[model samples]
Target: MNYMKNKRVTRKKEKHIKILYIIPSKTPTGPHIAILNMAIGISKNLKMKIFIITPKSFELNYKNYYEKLRESASIYEVSFKKQGILYWLSLAIKAFKLALSKHIDIIHTASLKILIPLGVICKLIPAKLILSLEGNPLYEMFEFSLFNRMIIILNWVIGMRLVDLILPCSKWLKSEMAQYPFLQDKLSFLHNPIDFERFQNAKPRGIRQEIGVPEKAPMILTVGRLHPVKDIETFLKAAEKTVKHHKNAWFVIVGDGPLRKNLENITKQLKISKHVVFTGFRHDVERFMAAADIYVMTSVYEPFGLVVAEAMAAGKPVIVTNVGGMPEIVGDAGLTVDARDVDALAEAMLKLLKDEELRRKLGEKARERIEKSFSAESVGERLVQIYGSLLKDERQ
Candidate 1:
């Protein structure tokens, strides 16, 4: 089938398949980065073509991220006025036109908002639909009225079943999707890819020094949005308890969100303001990861924690709340605790901080886990195998 396959003439003619990645983020996020890594892997390993479609406006601001992406895949920009409704409609029309006019193998998309429309479009065409999930949007529906929740759930029940495959970043998330019996056959584990070597060779930017902490201070780092779901408050509470047991351990929360001020105030209320620091949304996240003693994730509902893997790749022991995919990612490699439990979080954090040998052993395992499972080279093989199988199945 034909979409946009990177073509190179080899002595043995290899089949080239076109895979179009639909990314909805105006800026780069976990899903967007994963697609780029997968595209690079596909291009390098399988001699296939990859295409990335994103909003035109945001692409202009983030040209640095897109430039390297062009080497592996072709980039397409569409109008995204009013959050891309018009673009989706036009994308459907264009995709359908391509379905009849050209050969396109797969249309991969993430998020429930884009899933319904694009899934409908893929259903109208021969292209296979690959649904990539970062987190379940339905989980947030608890705040909605039952009627509204039921309406959305029914829509999801229908939409999810139409996809050719559902790709969750971890097996834990795959298990959650299995609740819908129809999704069982369609589900697969596609862990997010990380730049293992980049972290392996990174030079620490002294994030702690920049934040006024001593160079020797044991730094506990949490990198995520300052949102309710991220549960930074729990992290702060745990940090408050941690300092009592291990003084000179500085907690740095490196992200910005609606809850930033609230989290900051909580740090003040907890009276650990001197011990806790908030560095709002640094682009240099890996630098902070390189500088920290341990990484922490306190998400109440994480589908797959990317930063946890990155920290592991940086050879830092991680402390993650045992929710969703965190357990799957951190199993045997890092410490885990129950969600919203400050005592457990603090105890786990303290264990890593005090035990240098244990921390090093866990860190080594963390990097090995990422290298074996979450690296681009490893995941590229999975993508190539999956794409080849899908094509072969279609032929039969």
Candidate 2:
């Protein structure tokens, strides 16, 4: 009886694992939000103690998320106007000190910039370093200048080799990373989690009325920055053809970027300016998802489209480009068309718009997919299992 009682006590003592999440972004983007969501999920579903470190601007810009995060983890805010070398050095030093002071078991981050420096620091301590592959770093470097691209590549090479484990957000990303022989052993796929409750409970805020679309008009929505990689041009081209078949259909683009003016000009050229509404960046995306009859994503490259999952959680049928992880996210629940194929995109949109029964069925399946496989609790449980197995191997 005493041996059994002692075993229970030992198990109870081993339950808590100290984890520190370092987020380098000052602004709230999809990847940052995804990491924060996972942190919150880890705290809720495990006996783990969570710590988060980010720039002060992040806390200020994402007040609601900060508040939600604070309830689950301890937050350490730093000041940085720009992400220079000194800023990264300061962050690494801060993280190193905090990890030691708190006895952090694992240090996780989504930034390669953070991973390379922190990798050196983790060697001085007992903590394991984890890098979350939120996007394809190599592909993203094409947008930068030649000098900056080389610098980013150097970071990727060093960071990929230094981290103990690499968690890609999708199987497609894992396959991409596996091309590197060194990363083959460390790769694991972890899908980004959606706040199922938030999306499921979202109520329509009359976005259609505010945008001047009739109440009964079929509203097709796509949410992403107006960037070339997002392939918003293809969405517009498809919108042009889709409107020809269903003149009453409205296409709403819910983000802004460098390509806004060019995209608007294309709409004018196609004479479908009246059918497309660019709603800039919106915080009430769930509401917009609620108001939308269909959700579409046309990215030529995406690691994992969190917005697509959010839309699915909101019970909206999705149509995504057959690139990266989007087809994986949509699975059999919705349609997948070849990237840059305007006719295929238009046909998919028209099919969903024309058949209310098919849309309803797809929407139902989409929600079921999210609930069964990608909920916060499920993700948190998977994370805990990974941590446990890693630590167990270390002990053995």
Candidate 3:
């Protein structure tokens, strides 16, 4: 734990738990969204202060999309080199200075890359460190390349073990971490909180009509970054099958990433481009969900599909791949199908699209489940308890 280059507690005068959430990106990705929601809810309910440590370039988007949350929570735009050794050195120096100057009570990191430096710095000052695992890095590494695998191992060996708490979003992901003996006792499965009220109140009539899809069309929706891991190609193929019989059917994918061009090519090649609409990336995802009759997450693997919860909150019948923590999120409220099985995914989508009564019934059930289990209020309260306990223990 004492592997820091520099660390010191200058002014230990903060009244509340000062948590610094370290993350890589500030885009509208799930992890960033989760952190913002958690910060907003927790700040309102608990006497805690949060400082989000992110790149300076990310501030514009953060200000535009999350100004309200930022007003309540502090944001430290740290300048770091984009890559190589300088990035590591810059992050370490800035983190140490921020922690000491701000009298940060706890270092709560959400990115694996920063865990080592943060954990080591925490040990130098001997501050409590909490590491939240957002994705199964080992699986991602295996799915990617050897170099990535080494990075995953390094995180586990150096970062995960040193952290005081292991907050995993999914039990499935926690099980992956269980292989490490040091992390077993420190682990806690905390579901990512969703702002249900926002989605519940949002109406999508304008967005639906603007998208040019008939209001009566049985719209099937999926929202996430366009990537191979999302298995958008499979969803496009499944949409092809679904539209064959239901001519008024439509599939709306509402995000953009590297795989957009390839997925578009597949849609064109399948000759189903007319039935599928790629909205690139949109800020109004909840509205899109409201406009749709059914939601589907065809990810080959997802740590926890936050969009699935958002869809359920929007009161839309959902069909998600039975992968990662999605099955737990889906529970019995929505349908689950094997990932990569185009026929099965298509069948599930069609069933939801075709049955109006069933769709409504399932959507109602989905909303009930989210209200009971995944609301931001409930999640924030739980996190506050954990933070309080950790801070108390540190004081003792």
Alpha-carbon RMSD of each model:
4.3, 4.4, 3.6
Residue range with the least summed lDDT across 10 consecutive positions in model 1: 3-12
Native-to-model Cα distance after best TM-score fit, residue 37 in candidate 2, in Å: 1.3
Ten contiguous residues minimizing lDDT sum, candidate 2:
3-12
Model 1 Cα lDDT, one tens digit per residue, 1-396: 232222112211536677887766677688777776676666675457777677775456546456656777777776756653576576656555654444567887775555666677665555688878776657767866786577568658777777888788888888887887777898887888776776766777766678898999999999999989899999999998999989899998898989888888898999999898888977788888888989999989898888888899999999898888888877899988889999999999988888999999999999998899888778888988887776675544
Overlapping backbone residue pairs in candidate 1 total: 3
Q: What is the TM-score ranking, best to worst?
A: 2, 3, 1
Clashing pairs in 1: 2-103, 5-49, 6-49
Q: Pick the candidate with the highest lDDT.
A: 2
Where's the lowest-lDDT run of ten residues in candidate 3?
A: 3-12
Best TM-score goes to which candidate? 2
Q: TM-score for candidate 1, please give it.
A: 0.88
Q: How accurate is candidate 1 locally (lDDT)?
A: 0.78
For residues 1-396, what per-residue lDDT tens digits would candidate 2 score against the true structure?
A: 664454334544565788889988887787777778788678775568999889988667877678777777888877778888788888988998898777677898888766677888776765688888887788788888897777778878786777888899999999998888878999888898888888988998787788787788899999988898999999999999999889999999999999999999999999998888999998888888999999999999998999999999999999999999988888999999999999999999999999999999999999999988887767878988887776666443
Residue pairs in clash, model 2:
none
In candidate 2, how many Å is residue 226 off? Answer: 1.0
lDDT of 3 at 275: 84
Residue 22 of model 3 has an lDDT of: 69
